[model samples]
Target: MTAILITGGARGIGRATAILAGARGWSVAINYVGNEAAAQETLEAVRAAGGQALALRGDVSVELDVLALFDAVQAAFGGLDGVVVNAGIVAPSMPLAEMELDRLRRMFEVNVLGAYLCARQAARVLSRDRGGRGGSIVLVSSAAARLGSPFEFVDYAGSKAALDTLAIGLSKELAGGGVRVNAVRPGLIETELHASGGEPRRAQRLGAGTPMRRPGRPEEVAEAIVWLLSEAASYTTGAILDVAGGR
Candidate 1:
């Protein structure tokens, strides 16, 4: 059976992907920083969907936590087949000038640094030269990367742009090693992420402006992400897929 690890798997797109992986009968390792309750709930849902599940607690921004997370997955599953680097955060709307130093640091730390750490470990474990089977690494970036998020979240946008570059560069670096690297950019998704950004209805509010006339569902993005992690995308590498509804 395919074994996968999804960071920030307790909620949002991560949770959706974990449940979907479960339905496909894959062994899933769900990592969360806090909210064990939600993580356990997701864990139960995955098992209910017929997948072997493990709930791990870790803050992606911390190197020790990232290492422990990968180690735990290796210990439990014996090996890993795929990884979804989906843990990220967003702050309230603000112009670049109004953004505080601490906010910028936190944004880059979690979104960029955390992603790089995970990608690095993924390469180490999934490379054919490392004596392990090759696998996939799907980074969950944002449409904001290209859109620039303007007056709203330029910092977040910049951070996501880093992931896009990482996906492109790392894909080539690992292509010969049998590891496929890709990314999914989701736009205006309906999730608790907006509330944390201090705009509870941001998606619903701005979604009407998109070509699709509505915000995307978490499951919609999950489909694209899971596909990137599966053999169906075996020949697809270094691809940055946009899951936005033509926004």
Candidate 2:
């Protein structure tokens, strides 16, 4: 059986991905930071769909935690067939000049270093199948990376832009190794990501800015992620699938 690992799987997009992947017959290992209840809920939801799933707790920014999470998955499922590096954080909105240095550091810790650590470790375990074999790595990014969100939060946008480069570079480096690295850049997903912008009204403003005139559901982004991680994207790599709904 193909096994997959999804970080931040307690709720929102991560939970959606875990459930969908389970429905598609993949063994799922969900890694959440501190929400046992939500993680267990996801585990139950996936299992109820006639799929197998396990929940593990870990802070993705810590190397040891990430290593242990993968170790557990390796022990439970043998080896991972795919991974989604989706765990991250967004600090309260502030311009570079006004943003607190410590706040920016915290965001970078989770958004940039966390992804780097996860991908680095996952790459070590998942390599090319010389005889036509390999797995997939899907990184969750944001459309704000391109738009810059100057008036709102540039720090978060900058961090995601760094992730974009990480996906692109790793894609090239891992191509020969048979592992495909790609990213999903969502526009304005209804996920609580916007609440961190220091304004509960930010999500509404974003929705108004989008052509779709509504925020995207977590399930919508999960659909794109499941596709990229599946055999359907056999020939795809180093690509960013935009789930922004006409941003």
Candidate 3:
């Protein structure tokens, strides 16, 4: 059976991906820092989709937690076929000059360092050189990487931009090892991330500026992620797909 693990799987695009992977008959492992209730609900939904799922609690920013998350998945499902590094956080909009060190540290810790740690584990589990079967690694980035949300969180944008480079460099490094690395940059998507940024209706208000004239649904992003995980994208790697609908 195909087994996949997703960080921040309790909500937003991560939740949608977990549920959809379940529907596709993949054993899903969900990692959530807090909100056990939401994680349980997501686990139940995955089961409803006819797939086995385990909701594990851990903060990806912490090395011990990251280790525990991957350990739990390996023990439960034997090994992983794919991993989605999606656990991240957003602070209220603030210019780089106004942002405090703590905010930047937290953002880079969870978004950049956390992703690096998860990718490292995925590499170990999915590398042919390591005596394991190879698999896919998908990094959930943001359009803000390029757009650079001025007057908002430029730090977040900078961090995701770093992730884009990680995808490209890591993909090239692992291609011969049977592991494919790629990323999806979602635009103004309708996710709770906006509210966390202190703008709950930001997607609705700003989506009209895009050519699509609306924000994307979490499911839309999930589709791209799952496809990347599937064999259909066998020839694709190091790709940073933009799902922003032409912003």
List, residue by residue over 155-198, the lDDT tens digit for candidate 1: 99999999999999999999999999999999999999999889
RMSD of each: 0.6, 1.9, 0.7
State the displacement of the C-alpha of residue 30, model 1, in Å, after optimal TM-score superposition. Answer: 0.9
Instruction: Please report, as a residue range, the 10-residue window in candidate 2 with the lowest summed lDDT.
Output: 125-134
lDDT of 2 at 225: 94
Candidate 2: where are CA atoms >4 Å away?
129-133
As for TM-score, the candidate ahead, 2 or 3, is 3
Q: List the residue pairs that clash in candidate 1.
A: none
Q: In order, what lDDT does every prediction score?
A: 0.96, 0.88, 0.94
- Lowest-scoring 10 consecutive residues by lDDT in candidate 1? 123-132
- TM match of model 2 to true structure: 0.95
For each of the candidates, give the backbone clash count.
0, 1, 0
lDDT of 3 at 81: 88
Which is the leading candidate under lDDT? 1
